[model samples]
Target chain A: MLAFKLAFKNIFGAGYRTILNIAVLSFAFVTIIFYNGVIDGWNQQARRDTIEWEIGQGQLWHPSYDPLDYFSYQDAHGPIPEGMREEVSAGRLTPILIAQASAFPQGRMQGVLLKGIPPGQAILKIPTHELEAQDGQVPALIGKRMAQSIKMKEDDRLLLRWRDKNGAFDALEVTIAGVFDCNVPTIDGGQVWLPLAQLQEMLGMPGEATLLVAGEGFTPTGNTGWAFKDHDYLLADLNKIIQSKKGGSGVIYGLLLIIALLAIFDTQVLAIFRRQKEIGTYIALGMTRWQVVGIFTVEGAAYSILAILLGALYGGPLLWYLGKVGWAMPSGSQDMGISIAEKIYPVYGAGLIITTVLLVVVSATIVSFLPARKIARLNPTDALKGKIQ
Target chain B: MESIIQIKGLTKQFPVGAGKFTALRDISLEFHRGEFTGFVGPSGSGKTTLLNIIGSLDTPTEGEVTVLGRSIAHLTHKQSAQLRNQHLGFIFQTYNLFPVYTVYENVEFALLLQRLPTAERRKAVLDALEWVGLTDKMDSKPAQLSGGEGQRVAIARAMVKRPAILLADEPTANLDSKNSHHILQTMKQLNEELQTTFLFATHDEKVMGYLRRIISLEDGRVVKDEEIIMDKITEG
Candidate 1:
């Protein structure tokens, strides 16, 4: 406690210098954490979008569903194999069908991708924006781009046009109950979701969803098309897909780590140079090299704590506001019906924030030793003579 | 008399621009317990260097230095620091009281090395300040005091640890006549009351007059070592 108090007093003894050092360190901390937060935010958004569209928490597929797109559902011919139903009921499985279809809604005509889903089971696989209460049934949310192209709104009736096995235009008029804009350009512009029952009735295809993703609840035991549950593996797969879609977060983290180290190093060196005389006095007064080292290292730890607290205090709300009212997209893409929610989400996880703070403390502590070593080895006489380097 | 400090054949040299400059050379001296002694020399005559060696602030290149029966010149770096802390007190020409500390805290710092309890430390520190007649200024900083008051605070800080020897380098160099007299009287009284050995290096004639013994040096050699009765003591 005495060492800590003395170290703290020595640091703040020179008011201007201490404040200057803290300012430089705080700016450096902010820069590193900001970049770190951005990478985390981008990865989170990418992962959420990927889980919603490309893959899910886990996937269950037919036995014949191999790597080739053409080899789907050829092996397991039937009504989702009975056992997978148990997995879905236990919140471990989600069913999806990916099929191509044509959409003719008044003046808009285009071929679109259709995703058939069981909403209750789908929620377990891909997270959705939890909607508010409506009348009897939950609203069927359409992509913003799809809604804009057809000039549809809540309760507007539009025909879902597709081809049936009879080689005839099979059309069903469905109400556009809600609009969802998940900002992945491909998904928002071209896809629509329908209930599994409705999709089966319209396309005359029954008993099989194109893909089924199962989460951690079951272990596959032989030739039953059952796979073991591994949450780590599932997260890794999701992370890989996310990285491919958005970008590598590691590069940003690496750059910020280097920058933070350099900043702390510079601040500590300057502090040591400024306090060489005080260090000499301390040494002359019977403080050992190890005690002096501990003192300065603790000072570095204090600075790390202060900078992280200030950064978090300032950074959290700024990111939240950015996520809330995002920027407007460019005018040329105005026809795509871009919403504010999708463009600027700066969401972050607790683990990522904690890890970043820990890294800052470790880096600062390490950097402080460079100066502490110089101080510990200082000869009191030479140091008093002002020959400290 | 028991020797508080002994220096035999001591020499110090510094390297400067492809040449060797000797600061002290083949000096021998002994400081006895409960004595007031002064070292007088010209600039560059190495009074400060000799004092530093005695105070464990500097090491001799070619001699033996024993303080309180311990060979301080041969001690390790940490040992020398402990020697200074346990046995020696230092008063600088500028008083060297920590400017940021109040008078009480400045005195308390010397006692911090003792690891005394808080109540004992406070009592001893306040008592030391009272001995220097600066008890009223205990809460004031060094800058708030006059030159003599600041040096008194420095003296209090030095004596607070109850060190066996007090070493002062140019102790009166920065004082006016009145403050100089006050500091010398304080040191003399403390010498009589505490029986602590006081060693000083100075160019001030007034400082030398207060001493019972004088060791004068020239070119790092002790040219004169003599005892003289202090006239001010007889008058007081």
Candidate 2:
């Protein structure tokens, strides 16, 4: 307690020097929390967008299906399993058929994935119900990115050509029914959606699908020929991407902490060098050498405490405002081949805040203690005379 | 009178290059309670070294020196500190007052080490300030005081704990004659009223004139030990 009292007095006596150190340390504190909060916000937003726009609660793939291998789409489809038929009719499961195709828009050839879903399917947010055929033309839906690339709009006609299961090529004209906006790039780019029955009939493969999406809270109990993949398995790639981003942010955190701690360490070294007589005075007043050391150490650690308070004074409102209005990404960020929303709302979790505070405080204390240990070796006689020993 | 300090064959040495330099040679001395004694010598004559040894700030290299009742040679660092904290007080030539602390805080520091209660600590601090005639400057920081006022504050800090012994090394070295005489008179009054043993290391004639006894050192050896009769001293 005595050490604390003396330490506070000494720090305040330092005046502007104390404020400068606190300002630097508070910058580090606020920067660390802000960066981590932004990354976490992106992680949360990306995961949510991917789940809502592409993957549902989970997915079930045909035994031969490999989403990464385009050739696997040829043999990936089979008749819907009898057990899952009831679930599919009940809207608990939605089957989707995918076929690699090419589209000619304005006499330009572009490769695309033609996905077929029930017109009334509610399992995903693709606006598939807009795919209702009209005026003897098959209606199709495309994401905003795809529509922009193809230079087409609603009611525009395009020639789509694909090979049937029997190795026969067929061509058809489809009218663009809708162009939906989505944040998940994988689901938005280079994809077109058509009515399930129309695509199945065109491909000469009726009552067949390449994959089944499980709706929310629908658990698959019995095993069919198709394999069931849980949420973790389906979202592994997205998780890995988020983890890598966090690792990159960790480096920033380290750099900020090192700079702040270096300043504190330098201040402590100088204080010990300059306050020798004061140290001797304390010893002469009945304090042990260790007590003197404690006073200096506490003096250094007190800088961080002051910084925390200063940071809260200014950073609190700034962070709260950022969390509410969100940070807007660059216009072309959605083309980065990852799931990123237009604006990211930072989420400052209590755990992240507490962990950051502890890390910085503990680090500052250890740095402070390092130089203070020299006090234990100082000779009180020499110190009293302001002599270096 | 109680024998508060006893030194026998005491010596202190410092390493100089590859060789050892002796600061105090084999010497014996004794001091009793309430005695105003000074070790008078020129610079590097070991007067300060002897006072430091008696104050328990440094251990004798080759002798058993006892302050109060604890052997300086055998006292651990903590025990030495405790002895100094509880029974010994020190004043320095530079008046090493904590620059940031006010006069009151500086005086209160010693009692704080003793963990005195609030009311008791307050009374002791105020009394010590009154003794040094610094009651009006209780809230003034060390840098804001003159040389004499600073020395007086230092004196208050040392006397605040009411220790049995006070070691002062060139306490008036930086003060003018007027301040020096004033500081000495205040200390003399404290010695008479409280019976606190006053020990000093100085070559200043002003300080020597006020001493009841003088131990003169030359080249690390005590060359003269004399008791002064008050009637023979001229008032200056």
Candidate 3:
């Protein structure tokens, strides 16, 4: 306990050197916390956006359905079972028909997915009310990305070609009824939404859909020829993406830790090297070599106390403002191939702050102790003479 | 009088360049309680080496050194430190005061190591400071003190715990002639009043004038050991 008091006194006694070390360390503390908070916030926002836009509570897929195999579009679909009809009408289940098609807009051919959703249902976030056919023309809703790629505005017309369920080619003019903005690239890039019945009739598959998306409070009680997909199973691909992203972030975390620790290590080394006379003085004044080591270690570790206080003094307002206003993601975030929202509001949990404090304090103590242990080997008499060796 | 320190066939060696260089050779010495003695010598004459051996800061390299009846040669590092903490004090040529600590804290540090209670420790520190005439400078750090004042603070620090013996190595080397005499007088007064043994390693003539006994060393061997009687000891 007395060693702690002496150590505290010594740290403050160091004057400007103590201030410089604490300032550098506090910046590191705030920065590490901020980066971790931002990454977690991004992960949460992506998950929420995915749930609202693409996948609902869960999904049910036909036994043969494989989204990666475009050729399976023909075999992956089956007629909606009798059991799902009532639930589908009541909006607890949403049926989507998927087919491969190509559009020639102003002499340019682009492959796209033709997704058929019910016009009156509100199970998803898409604006499906505009999917009603206008004067026998197939009304289609395209994303802003698709609209930019094809340079097609609302009320414009494009020719779409597709193969029917009976191995027949059919083509029709699809009129762009709306161009919508969304963060989920799956729904917004090279994909068009049209009415379910019109698409089923056009493809000669009158009562079939590729998969069924379950809505909130939906319970699957065994439907024939359909396998129930739980939330974890449906979001497995997204989880894998997020996990890899976390792995990448670990590299960055490691770099930040090394930079901070290096600064601390350098300061400790210099202090020990410069203060041999002090070490000798302490020994002469009745301190054991180990006690001298402890004084130095505590002096080094004491930086964390000031670092944390300063971090909170400045970081509290900055983090609170960030939590409210959120971080604005860069313009081309969607091109990075992860579901990042336009803006992500960082969430700083109590667990994050506590863990960071423990990590920094422990690390500082260890780093401090290692260098000060060198004092144990010093010759006290020679050290008293200010001998370097 | 009980012997406070005993040395038998004591020798210290330093490994220089290729072989060992002997600093002290086959020296036998004993010091009684309440003695004011000076080991007088020029540089490299083994005076400081003898003091370090008796203070438990260095090993004998050849023979036994017993301080306050404990064999320093067989003492573990911790035991050696305990002996020094409880029974020995040291004043250095450079004062060696902690630059960051005020005079009061520096003096209080000795009592602190003994785990004395706060009130007693305060009294002890204030008493030590008063003895050195630095009561008004209790809050002043070492940097603010002159050479004489700094040495006085060091004397207060060394004597605060009232150790049985004090080891001083060239304690007056950095002080001017006037300050040197002043410190010597203070130490002589403390030695008489407290009945504390004082051992010095120095060649300063002013320090030699205040000594009741002088052991002269030359080339790693004691050449003269004598007691001097004078009608009047110089107050300086």
Chain B TM-score, candidates in order: 0.96, 0.98, 0.97
Model 1, residue A249: displacement in angstroms?
7.3
Question: Which candidate gets the maximum TM-score versus the true structure?
Answer: 2
A1-389: candidate 2 lDDT, tens digit per residue: 98889998999899888898889999999989999999999999988888887888888899999989999999999999999999899998899999999999989999988899999889888888798777888999988889999999998999999999999888998999999999988776888899999989989889999999989767888879899988799889989988998899889878988999998899999888898888887887778899999998888788888898999999999999999999999999888888998999999999989998888788888999999999888888878887855
lDDT of 2 by residue, B1-236 (tens): 89988989988899999999999999999999999999998899999888888877787889889888889889888998899899998989999888878999988998888889999999999999999988999999999999999999988888888889999999989999999999999998899998999999998989988899999999899999998887644363
- Could you give candidate 3's per-residue lDDT for residues A1-389 as a string of tens digits? 88788888987898887887788778778877887788888778777877877888877788888877888887878889889888898899899999998889998899988998888867788888899766877899998878988899999998899888887888898899999877778887888888999899988888889888888878989647788887688678778887887678767776766676677788888877787778887887778999989988887678877788888999889988998999998988876656777888998989989988887788888888988888889888887877755
Instruction: State the C-alpha RMSD over the true interface residues for candidate 1, after superposing those residues.
Output: 2.2
Candidate 2 regions exceeding 4 Å error are B232-236
Mark the regions of model 1 whose C-alpha exceeds 4 Å error after superposition. Answer: A20-57, A63-79, A82-95, A105-109, A117-141, A149-151, A154-189, A195-198, A201-204, A213-222, A225-238, A241-276, A289-294, A305-361, B230-236
* A206-281: candidate 1 lDDT, tens digit per residue: 8666666654544544455544334465456546654543345456556665665666577677767765655656
Look at candidate 1 and give me any clashing residue pairs.
Answer: A58-A213, A59-A213, A60-A212, A60-A213
Highest DockQ among the candidates is held by which one? 2
- Docking quality of model 2: it rates as medium
- Residue A174 alpha-carbon offset, candidate 2, angstroms: 2.2
Using alpha carbons, what is the TM-score of model 3? 0.94
Error of 2 at B65 (Å): 1.2
